[model samples]
Each structure stands twice: as C-alpha cells, then as structure tokens.
Target: MPVRHTDPPPAPSRAPSSVPETPARTRSQKVADSPSLMAIVAIAAVGVLLYTVFLFDFGHRGDWPAYLLVVVAESFIVVQALISLWTILSSGHDPRDYTFNEAQRALYGNQVEQTMAIGIGMRHAEMQLNDFPITVDVFITTYGEALADIRKTVEAAVAMDGAHTTYVLDDGKSAAVRDLARELGAEYVAREGNAHAKAGNVNHALSITTGDLFVILDADFVARPDFLHETVPFFADPTVAFVQTPQTYGNLRGLISRGAGYMQTVFYKFTQPGKNRFNAAFCVGTNVVFRRTAVMEIGGIWQESKSEDVWTSMKLHERGWRSIFIGTELAVGHTPETIETYTKQQLRWATGGFEILFRANPMGRGRALTLDQRLQYFGTATFYLVGIAPGLLLLVPPLQIYFGIAPISQDVPGLTWFFYYAGFYFMQIVVALFTIGSFRWETLLLATASFPIYVKAFANALLRRDQAWSVTGQKGVRNSPFTFIVPQVLAFVFLLATSVVGVWQAQLDRAFSLAVFWNILNTLVLGAFVVTALKESREIARASRELRALRRAGREPVGEHDEKVVTPVLPEPREERRAVAIKPVTPVPPPRPAIAATQAVAAVPRRHRAVAVRGPAPRPATRPTPLPPLRPAAPRPPAPVLPSQSGPPSISGPLPGLPIGGGPGRARRSAGGPRAAEEPEPRTAPVPVVPSPRRRSASGADLAAEVLSFSGDSFSGDAPARRRDRRSR
Candidate 1:
C-alpha cells in the first residue's frame, strides 16, 4: 500500500485536496541498501578478478579448441559480471527528488479544475503543468489479448485520478473490444492494417489524439489511480522525454510466469534505477509516459523493428532528450505464462538488442549520447550475448566425456579448479541473494533453458529475417509447450547420453569423474524444463479433451476460446476439510433487548451474517473430528426503566426467540401497549441440538439449518406466521 507523505517546502504552496503518495525511502533503508549493494559489488569484483587470473594462466591451457571455447565463454561472462557490478555500484540514485515531489504537489491546483467525464460519469483531478491544465492521453495498446483483460485495463485507465482521455487501440479489429470500449466510455481506435504490429497501433492513435503528454499501457497493464501523479510530474523537467516504470506483474501463478518474472525482477529493482543515473533509462513499450513533442521530433514511434520501444528511445536519446526510469511499480500486468509466449517475448527483446548493437550502434558514429549513455547502451546491446555463453558452457562436460579432452591442463589439481570455479559461480549466487533479496532457483532454470531463444534471436538478426512463428496457444485449439522447446529436449537427450557414457567410463576405471557429475547435473537441469513443458502440454491436451466432450454432449456451444483451460492444480488434503468441518462459530450481537452475543470460542461477527468458511466435505475413513462442546450464552442486559413507567413491565414469553431452541414471539414494553422501541418484527428462533452417537461431527451449514428450523412448542405464537417467517429467515 502507498503511504501519505508530506515535506515542508521552503515556500508555501497550494494544492487541490490530497493524493496518495509513494513511500519515501527512510534513513534506515538508505543506510541498509547502500551497504548491502557495496558488499555485493566488492564480493563480485574479487571473484571475477580471481576467476580471470585463473583462466588466463598459460600453464592451465589444454586442448586448443576446448581451451579457446572456455576462454571466450568465460570472457563474456566476466564482461557481464563487470557491467552488473558497475550498475549495482550506481544503484543509489532516485530520479524522484524534491523537484519531482514538488511538481507532483502542484500538479492539481484549486484555482481552475480540469474535468473530463470518462468511464460512466467519472471525473478526475486537474492535470496541470506549471499550474496550467494540460492534456494527457492514456493509450492502451492491444493486439489479440483477452477482452476481459482489456476491459480491466481500460476501466482502470479511465478511472485514474487525472484529467485525461483513455483510448483503447485495438489492432485485432475486435468488434467486441470496440463495444466494450463504448460501454466503458473510453474512445475506441482501430486501424485498417497492423502494419507495424504494436508500434503501428500506437502510432495510429498518435496521429488523431492530440494530448500534450501520452501514457502507453499494454492491454494487460492496469494503471494505478495515482499513475498520472507519479509519472506526469517528471515531465516538469523540460528535457525529460519520457518516464518509464518497471513492468511489474500480479499473476505469478504458473511456473513459466514465475520464472519469466524472476528473470526481469532484478533488472527492474536494481539495474533500471542504476541506469537512471546515466540518463539512459529506456522505455519498455508499456507503463511509460512520453512527451508528444519529443516523440514527434523523432518522427512517429520507430516501427521498422519488432522492438520499437528501444529503437524509439535510442532515437530520442540521440536527439539529446533525457529519460527517467522510476523503480516504483506504478502499474501491474501479467507476464508470459506459457513457453510459447516466453519464447516469443525473449526473442523479440534479444533481436532488438542485437539490432541496436549492429545496425545503429549507440557507441558508433552519427549519435549524440554521452559517455555514460554510451557505456550503458553498450551494456544493453551485449546483455543477450551473455545468454549465449550458457549454451556453449553446457558442451564442456560433453567434450570431456566423449573424448579425453579438458579445458584445463591435467597438471592443475581438481581442487584448485573447483575453488576458482566456485569463486565465480558460487559468488554470483551470493551476489544475487544480496541484490535481488533471495536467490530463486526458477531464475537459474529459466536462464539455462532459454539460451536457445537467444541463439535463435541472434541468428535472425544475423540473417536479417524474422523468426516467423504462427503459434496457436491461445484459442480453443492450443499447441503443446513441447512444440516450442524442441531444442531443450534435444539438448537434454544428448547430455543424458554423455552422462551415461561418462558414468560407464568411471565404473571401468574404478574412479570418480567430475565431468560425469557435472554432465549429470546439467542434464537434470534441462530435464526439469522439459518436465515443465510436459506438464503444460498435458494441460493443453486435457483442455482440448474436455472441450471436445462438451461439444459432443451439446451442453456448450463452440467458441474462439476455451475459457476452462486446465491449469496445473493440486487437490486439497483431507485434514483441512476435517478441521473446517469441526470448527466452531457463533452469531454476532443483534440490536435487540433479548439476544445478546456471547464471548464464546471462535465467535464470528455478523458484519454480513458471515457463513463460517469451511473446506470440502470430510472423508469417512479420516478420523472423526468431534465438535467442541457448546457454551452458554451470556445473560441479557436488564432493560432500562423509563421514568414515566409506573411499575416494572410484565414479562412475556422468555426473550422473543433465542436463536437456539426458544419458540417464536415478540417481547414488548407492555403486554400489548407497543413493541420495544427500535425493535424489528419477531422471526422464528433457532434450535441447538446435542450430537447423536452416530454423528461424527457437524458442518456449519448443517448446524445453521438446524438452528433456523427450530419448531419448538416452548412459547405461544401464530403457527402459520412463525413458519412463514422461519422460511424467509
């Protein structure tokens, strides 16, 4: 949750009402984060230095081919480590300083309100620039995403607490989406063709909508109510071209989603903040705010490449426009939850990096980037190349297994090699722990499994062609995840065979081989990814089978999407159900003189007459959970006496109707004068039944039914009215 923050300004300032503010880093957090970051850099620097020393030692060289491969891969790894450490060292910068905060405070003034009716009669706070109201267009770019997801994003975009127009740019030409936009009161944008894919969709919106500053949110990214307040203030700096927030996600339910999210978590939390110091923070196609003039100056958003975001940002940077990347999560959406989506996403991003590295190098001629920007962009270009190293490194064990060849000279003891290896790789894990908070094994698995994607992206860039893929994963008919991870399966099989041979060789020699162990571990790592894909494949097949069954039975109609995609789920255990079945519950106090609540165990309040939450029905084989003994209700408070009353009012049937066992009747101030003041008409009370020997335990619903069905003859009442009131209650 966001907190309220107020800082005394040097001069007094006026604002319209109040706004929720992002939490500011406390002095303790600043103190703790700095030391932790430096520690990581220090430890990582020493490890890389020692590993480089061990690698370059001439005496450790073995076979030329294997040795050269090892050196090249390790060199790239070392370069990546150096860049990461440098970035971590510069992670102390916060783009949102006093200026940004002050600008945010003055974003809405009380002098003149700027209101636009959006989203079913919703209006927002004034969006001001220099205390003058400014126009902002919030664009949600969609291309074949689910309509429900798009609706959520559009609703949020319109409801944002700022005077802005929300538009849904539907590149899929979806009529349903257009209707949804109309129903939501958001403008609908459709184009004749998706010439440049997402970039074209946005550019088309740019042509007609004339907002001074525009925000771009992906179809699934839902902006927060204060998103405009957060990013719009950064543009107060005239030179700032855009404000980019991290692409945070809320749907981390699938393994693929978790792995893909973890892969970028560090970049958003640590690297982007560090990049902001160099004014090299780039837009990521979503959750970004761009100045219209800066974008117009760079022509429309660059549409030649798949990654128009980085390409456009490069053009803006070359044009000498500054960019800001805030580390805050202003909007959240879903990350790729399937192998096909993950592969396509990674491929596109990597291709963009390589294209920038080659076609229009930031470090090359005809550019106006500073030294800091040059180094940061160069790092970005080479980041994906580091992914290629893992694929090459996986082959080292096989080299030793197939032929008696090794990267390290036999003269070097195994222990020395292990120590040097640990210094680099083990220390990297420690660095991840410090920087990313906790080390995630899923990240490692995804990283290792995704090398083929990077390799394919590089190949596509090298060939100057697109990696055309018409995957069918998101309609009624779905493709198996295995279709996308063929390389991983082949690699796993080869490594497994190599490990088997290595194991046999070790057995024949009556000795242990580190190569066999390493090969086996790598094989298992790959196997885990294959297993994940297999699980997804099974889910897709199961969904297809169920859809077919539904169609055959004529119980459901055909549709473009199978809403019931069988996600991987585990069943609840029997113990939880038993516990829930035996749990106790009591009603909260009512506004009456007779039935006051008791402080019994597990007495749930009746805010809405809560149905005690319980798990599924328990099994007969499981141990019977005996219900706890019921406690007696507390005595009702004595009715207050009115000074006008002559004597104590005559009592009627015991308290109009206890919820348990007491018969139905209304208690009164006098026998027939009038009912108690502020009292509602009487209803049938409940019955409390002691458990029979045959009963194991009782569920809340069963007990509540018994309590409401009480027909006890203890008190006098009209039988028909009592039964009718009981049924209704």
Candidate 2:
C-alpha cells in the first residue's frame, strides 16, 4: 500500500478522510500472472523432460551409472525449483507479510489502534497520580567490548525517553566498564560466574533489578531514542510477551560485513515477516523488548542453552503469550569484520540452534504451539543443518569428472539438461532478488563460499559436542588464512584439474562438454568464495589498522559513512572546570555606571537597593575642560573668499576659560588691514596641517602619572607652555 501524507484530522471522532483513493486489486492473481517467471519455469520443465526422454541412451553409454545419477539430481533440482517459486508466490498471497522497505499499513489497522490505546491508557494512568510508572529496564550485555563502542550505546540508551534505567551487565567485570556506567549515570551489574555467558548475565540482572518492561541489547547494538516508545506500546495487548525489531548493521564497508549483511537481509525482511503471520516470530538475541512478568513466568531466559532467546520465545508461545516481529530496524550494530569471526559466530549460532532442536524441540508431544508454530520452529532449527548441501553439490561434479564417474550418461542430450537447469536457476535468482531487499549476484557467491563453515557447524552438532559461547570479536584483525576456506579452495582445485584432464582426453561429446561446463561453473562459484575470503581478511587488517590510527589520533572510528550507529545521541557530560580562564580583554562592552546601578538595584534585596544603586560616588578633583566655541569666517565682499580670508587654520584651540578665537596675549588679525576689505587678498602661507600623533610610546609609570595628573588638574594650566613647545618645534 502506498503511504500518502496529509493534514491530520481535526477531530478524533472522524475517520482519516484525506487519504488518496486506494488502487483496485485484480479479481485473481496467480504465479502464471508473471509471464517472465512462467516462461522460465515452462522452459525448464520442457528441457528436463526432453533430457529424461531423449538424452539418456542407457544401453550404449559407458558412464551409465553416473549419467543416471545426474538425471536424478536434475529431477530433484527441478522439483525444488518449482517448490521455491510456489513458496515465494504463495507468501505474497497473505496480506500479513511486510517488508521494511514498504508496508501494507491497512492490514495492521487493529494493531495500530491497540498501540494508540496503550498510549492513551498510560496518559490516563499518569493523570491518576498513581505510584506505578511503566518502568523499562535495558540490559546491555558485554564481555570485553571497547569502552568507546560501549559509551556510544550506553549514552544513547540513557537518552532514550521513558521512565527507564539502563544497566550495563559486565560479564567481564572490568573496572573500566563499571566506571563508564558510573560516568553515564547507569547502573552497573556484574556476575560471579560465566555459566551460560550472556544469557546468564541477563538472568543475574533479572534477579537484581525490577521493571515493567525489559529490553536486551547487545553491547554493540545501539537503540534509537524512541525505541521504547515504538516497541513498548505493543504490550497493551496483555498477551504480547515481547516485541522483536530487526537488528541492522551500521558498517558494511568490508566484504565480510557486506556478505553477512546480505544473508541477514533475507531473514529479517522476508523470513521473519512470514513467520509473524502465524505469531511464530522468534526472538533474535538483541533489539528486543520483553514483558518482565512474561519472562519470569517463562522461568527467565533459558539458562540451559546458548540459544536461550529461541528457547525462551518457544516457552512463552507455548504458554499462550504472543510475540511481534516489528520488521523495522530501530537499532544498529556492527557485523563481524573478519572471516574467522564471521565463521565462529555462524558456528555458535548453528550449534545452538541445533541444540534447541534436539533438546527442547518445539514439536515435542504436549507442546501448546500450533501446527504452524511447530513447523516454524522446526524450520529455523533445521536451517543450520542444511549447510551440508552446498558442500555436497560442490563435490559431486568434480569427483565425477576426475574419476571418470559421470553423474549422467553420454547418451543423455546435454542441451536439454543445460537449458532446464539454467531456466530454473535464472527464475529463482530473479524471484529472490525481487522479494528480498538486497539482491546482489555477489551475495550468491558469498553464500556458496560459506559452505565449509556450515559443514563444520553441522559436524559439531552431529557429534553432540557441547560448545561454549565465544563472543564474536566485533571489530579486529584476526588473520583468517586461506585454510579457513579450505573447502572452497580444495573444490576449486579439483574442478580445475578435472576439467583440464577431461578436455585433454578429448572426450568432447555433448554430454562430456556439459559435465565439464557444470564442473567449471561450480569451480568458479567456489573460487569466488575463495577470493572473497582473501578480500575479507585484507579488509579486516586494513580496518584494524585504521581503527588503531583513529584511536591513537584521539578520534572515533568511522563506520558506515552515512549510517553510523548511535553517535552518542546525548553528548557525554562536559567536564566542569573549577577555575575558568577569563581573557584579559573581554568582548562584551562594560556597562555604564548608571545602567549598572539600575541593574544592581533590581538584583539586590529591597532594603539594599538604595545602597547598591547609589554606592558612594568617587569625587572629581577638577572640573572638565569646556570645549571651544566655533568662529564664523569673516566675509569677503559678494565675491569669492580668498585664501587670505582663511588665515592659517588653528590646529589647537585655546584651552578652556581662555578667550574664543584668540589667546590672552595675541590680538586677532583682520581679513584685510583695515583698507581694501572688498578686494580678495593674495594666498598666504598654506594652512599648516599638524598630523595626529602616530603612536603612544609612554611607559606604564608615565602613562599612570599622566592619567592621575589629568584627573587632578585641568589642561588649562599647561596650555600656553604646550603652545610654546609646539612653536619651538
């Protein structure tokens, strides 16, 4: 649905009346409606049928067994391809599915109204002046995160608008962490043991603090100022146990971050929303708000497993509580910057997910989850188990080529197989890119590259190995050698060697060429992963060096240039200096004595106003010198006034109390010597223009003495002497 902005309704009683007319929907919509998609699927289907019927000459083919296997594999691929198309198309049929990019707001009208009602109820509750304010407790769990990183998140959390208190659960028990919490005015809590890692630390917090609502934030994930306002209101429905917002990463400069982010895009944007339709949106470890009562009722965060978030959500759902997936990302964090960290993070999550699947299966008997909910949990658990497929797919072709064990007989027509496979592959890629937000072809390469990590995780889970949680080193250079990507490297090598041998042997029949083409293609895909791993390692090293440089320079490290996370929403409290250095010369003009008196009077106590306003005035020793009067110019006749008329201009006037236009001893000169007053006289000496003094070079003592002497005596006393000195010069 398109969102249109307009003036809000003046009255709440009236419905929103200015919204644009909604577009009409088609009477029926189906997968076939998409001509391009249908064309690919149809082509793929026909190609598969052609290959199965005409290409497979089992009687004469030397590699008949391998050819038969290839046929079966292609058939399986076609089936899964169709299933994917069906799933994607069917997903859109439900009105509940929403993406962060665009939302069908009309479908969530009831949820919006209830959320508004929650706000209204809070306002009414406040009006009653009751003792209870909805208290929200935010827990930031950290092991050994940098203080600078933690400061940004903690500051933002404290700045969040609500009746809330932030707690820094320092599992590492670092004094620096404690001091930072103190500096930020947040409560700091530490535990004595690391029994269940972050989950245990949170449980410890639950035992100590109390609040109506609880929020869990990873050490690096920073919440928006309005996070509580946006998420907490959903709890108005008593059944809502928690609200989960998408966890977005702020930095995506590195290959590792970009690739990992692509994988997350699918889950948060597509899978989570689909799960929300059935109220099966499981909690993602952070950026989530939970009802305190609901958590306590569910026995706190499940301490038995590292995937406590999933287990706890399951328990809550089983107890008839609800969860909401807000699809919107109101918080942002950092992604693992190195291949090793990324792999380790994936391994831990994969292992834990499988642990939940085995130990506390949601589909177990007597569980209260609906059939849909059970399937959702099962699907989530099995997600980690399916990592082995890419590895197997990578292996089959290379092994068949090198060992002369072709998966399909040469009797099979290669073009039909290739056409069908290509069609399905193309359509699937298109649909995924259209549905999921981030649709990069490079992401497919990255996904296929991560096969080794998945295989290792699966192996760990299969062996029932008890894995402990190891914090993902959020930002650092951990040398992830090519060895970490052994699977891709080895696969690429095998495929390359096998392709060379097959071409050299000149088994260049259509089927042989097809097999070579498929192996080479898979090899290239695996090679892309190898290159990405190398790039990721180099990026991690560069990032680490840059980070260190920034720190040494006393500057904050840069993340995404445009989308930096939690940049200290509320600035750190500026340190107050005990003594402020006042410049010798102030910029502000000094207040006049009279105006200052008035201001002092206004500020002083009533009885002291008179004393403040009229404090004893300093007595003047001598009266101020009166300025000289202006002398009118003597007129010439009705003719021009000659230079003689303007006699030598007086640069200095007579001192105060002296006669105007003349000294006490000198007589004034007339314009003409008592005779030819009507005629103009010749120009006399040009008026002497004495320049102003260039600089004052008086010493401090002399300057002080001059000021005192001037204040004590008038300039009249020295006027004649100064005139004599000027004349001598």
Candidate number achieving the greatest TM-score relative to the actual structure: 1
Please write out the lDDT profile of model 2 over residues 1-729, one tens digit for every residue.
111122211211223222122223321222224555455545554554554454354553446555554555445444444433333332233332223112222313223344344342111111000112244668888877767778888887776644466778766666676667777867666545555777767765654444557799988877775566557656545567788987777676666666776667656655565566677888988999987666755546776666778988998888777788765456777777567777778878888787767776877887798987887787777675445456556655655666767655466566754664565566556555544523666566666677677666767766887666766554333666575767668777877787787666555543455556767777787776677777766766797888788899899654311221221011122222122223333222111112233333343233111100010111111112211111124332221111111122121221111011111111222212211212121222333334325214656554433333333333234535544655676
Candidate 2: count of backbone clashes, pairs at least 3 residues apart or interchain: 10
Top lDDT hit: 1
Candidate 1 similarity to native, TM-score: 0.72
Candidate 2 positional error at 567, Å: 31
Model 1, range 450-469, lDDT digits (tens) per residue? Answer: 99999998888887886542
How do all models score by TM-score?
0.72, 0.60
Q: In candidate 2, which residue ranges exceed 4 Å CA deviation?
A: 1-132, 362-364, 409-412, 475-477, 506-512, 535-729
Alpha carbon deviation, residue 384, candidate 1 (Å): 1.1
Enumerate residue pairs that collide in model 1: 659-686, 661-686, 661-687, 686-707
Alpha carbon deviation, residue 226, candidate 2 (Å): 1.3
Worst 10 residues of 2 by lDDT: 608-617
